[model samples]
Target chain A: MPAELLDGTKTANEILGKIRSQVAVRVAGGGSKPTLATVLVGADPASITYTRMKRKRCESVGMRSLKVELPAETTTEQLLAEIEKLGNDPGVHGILLQHPCPPHIDERAAFEAIPTAKDVDGVTLGSFADMWFGLGGFDSCTPGGIMRLLRAYDLPLSGKRAVVIGRSAILGKPMAGLLLAADATVTICHSRTPDVAAAVREADVVVAAVGRAEFVKGDWIKPGAVVADAGYNAGNVGDVEHAAAAERAAWITPVPGGVGPMTIATLLEQTLVAAERDA
Target chain B: MPAELLDGTKTANEILGKIRSQVAVRVAGGGSKPTLATVLVGADPASITYTRMKRKRCESVGMRSLKVELPAETTTEQLLAEIEKLGNDPGVHGILLQHPCPPHIDERAAFEAIPTAKDVDGVTLGSFADMWFGLGGFDSCTPGGIMRLLRAYDLPLSGKRAVVIGRSAILGKPMAGLLLAADATVTICHSRTPDVAAAVREADVVVAAVGRAEFVKGDWIKPGAVVADAGYNAGNVGDVEHAAAAERAAWITPVPGGVGPMTIATLLEQTLVAAERDA
Candidate 1:
């Protein structure tokens, strides 16, 4: 049987439609429009493109977008000051900082500067702690998207064995925390792990977040396992070698059509949620 | 083969003795005496005794102690302010707010007030993030103590399958994070977990922190498994039912002497470390 795809694009659209109606109600009530402040450091083309796309999405959903761009040579102190400015601004409900700032800039420090209440991107220490501690609030967009996808499928997360490959701050680690909060037995593996495939073979659910292209072979999957490929390689390849994994996975997400679209959709949904909370 | 005991009282004394000399050096060099601040709310006899014990330990090492006691009726705002004062105080290198602060108080908010830099107790959001992310300056004392006990015995951690039975903010969850950081495949189990004994049986290392006396059975432990019990039930019992487990485990910590003293020792050790880092 072919693996059933978790269509992120369709799911995202469904969420966006709901958000549109909610935004209309708030506007009709004469409430201030939900405002998201986007902060981009330096002129990285990819960051610029992503920021523009997010802003476009916000506009389409009847939300306000505020974009702030900074020079490549900006110091941490300066960037922090800018973030503080947005944090205090009455008009802004959420702040999203395009990450991977210049190596010299302390990105974590920069992320920390965003007020916890306004951290729509959920990159602050407070947000990370809430996610890790299972206390609730916003989550990293992509991982949040994966949770949404799982919930949509009506899958049982409680008491399942979930093996997460990779431990990056933004995705893998947070994803593992989310799964654990859902009562899943979570195992985190990385490059230093002696045998990743063996770990994967025992998983009821496998979440692949390691950045390598097609790193997880199809033969590694347990039969009837739910496979989530959160990895996106340069040519649209995922951590899971799709062909082989498709044969074994009862449910699988494709790299391009799967996790990618869901990331931005979750971001928008959470931004609206934060706006409501703030309002 | 009979299980070897992991002695905490002896190990804690050894660590404290080392810290004492270092503190002496700092005093001789005309540096300010290292300080540990304890914010105790109300007169819980148990909390009082624990704080006093911690203060006595600090004094033995030539460190200064600052005590802040509040009434049981203290507001969340009042407690938060006290913690914030300690966090910002340069004289307070370490801060420990006695846990189980009056039930009405927002314990997490109080914990949040202590800055990561002075969170020698490792209960704050900042410290938790650092601990989980593995870029650690401080860790929760109990878990750190457990790690120390394991390392002292030359127990192998990397790539081992570890099961942590408990998911409290201070103990089990952080314990799993520490093990994961050490490259162990960590599984965190809570009361909601199903087949906990089965999960425990598969572990190379099992840490019982559920606070229930004798909850972990002998049959749950794998042959030659390493076990760390951080439970301190009333009347000197521990989370792991000791007698039968001793027969199965390769190494196991006894209840009273196993993890209690190590936790107190780790607090002092980390306090001194925080002081030196500040110096």
Candidate 2:
């Protein structure tokens, strides 16, 4: 039997709808508005589009969005200072730094400078620690989205063998941490891994976050594996080749319809979660 | 061939002897002495013993030791405030909050109150981040101890598969982070891991930090695997049943004679490193 698709677009919209209603309630009560502030460095067209999508989502949910744009040549110190300002701002409920900031900037340092409370994107060590430790506040949007999608499908994570490919701070590491917290025995594989396929094959749940297109082969999947491909590569390809993996995995998330829309949706949901705390 | 015993006690003393000379040099230069402040909540005999051992280690190496004892009934805020005081004190180069500080205390928040630079025990988020992100800084003592012992044996960590059992913040989690930072494909299998033996058998290196004695079976070891038993169970039994694992592993660390001494030695070594940085 072919694997069932873990349709993320539908799942994300359901979450957003709940967030939208909550925002309406707060607005009706005349409470302080929930706001998300995003800082974008330079004007990369892709980043611009991504930021616009996030802003539109925020507005749709009735949350306020603040946009900060820095010139391409901005100094690391200047970027950090601005982030610190937003971190200290009373009205900013959550802070998101649009990644791939110009090459010379200290991205990690900038990410760390954001206050843990305002770190709705869950990029900071504070967020990772809290999330991994299961003392929750905010989580990295993509991982949070993946968890939401998994739970929506009634997939039990407890005692499951989960393999997460890639260890990028924004995705893989946190994803493994989340899975581990969910009571799954998690293995994190990356470029240094000796055998990625063999590791994935052992997993009941496989999370593919490596950016390569169809990096995880179909045969590497267990017969009933729950496959989550977070990769949105060029030409709408995912980390797993859909056609082949579809026949193997018990449940699989598609490329364009799967993780991409969910990423933005999760970010919006977390922004509301962050705003709710402030309200 | 049977595995060679990686001698932690001998390696630890060798490093400690080096630190002693460095301390002598600093003292000769008329610098304010390197100091380690230890906070003990209540009197778990084990906690007291560990604190005394650390103080003794500090004194032996020409570093000053300041011990603060709090009553068992102390509030979380009270404990945090004391740590904060030590954090700001110029004389203190290191802060060690002995673990299992009264079950009622918020251990995580208490650890966070210590400034990142003075966290010689590497208990804070900064240390975890450093370990995870591959930036050089202090590490949790036992894990630091394990790393020192491994490097002393000329073991190569990069691109190796490392399986760490246990997931405590101070030990297993940080150990996996350290291994991952070294470019090892790291797996953290805890009580929740269903196939612990399978995970252990596949590792190029195995770290047993789960407290259970002889929990890691000998037959599960991959021949030629470098095994470090970080569990110092009662009656001197390491987490790995030493006699059996020693026969299978290519290189193994013994229980009492292995990781125990290395813990204090790594603490002292990192103290000197912090002292040197401060100097």
Best DockQ among the predictions, by candidate number: 2
Give the range of the ten consecutive residues with the poorest summed lDDT in model 2 chain A. A270-279
Candidate 2, B-chain TM = 0.98
Query: Tens digit of lDDT per residue, candidate 2, span B1-279?
Result: 789999998999999899988999999999778899999999899889989988998898888999899999999999999999988888889999998889899998999998888989998887887888777778999998999999998999998989999999889999988888888988889887888998899999999998998999999999889999988778988899888888888999977889989999988888888878888
Best by lDDT: 2
lDDT of 2 at A59: 88
Instruction: For candidate 1, give the lDDT of residue A164.
Output: 91
| Total colliding residue pairs, candidate 1 | 0
Question: In order of the candidates, what TM-score does chain B achieve?
Answer: 0.98, 0.98
Model 2 collision count: 0
* DockQ metric for all predictions: 0.63, 0.75
Candidate 1: residue A86 Cα off by (Å): 2.6
Q: Judging by TM-score against the true structure, name the best candidate.
A: 2
TM-score of chain A of 2: 0.97
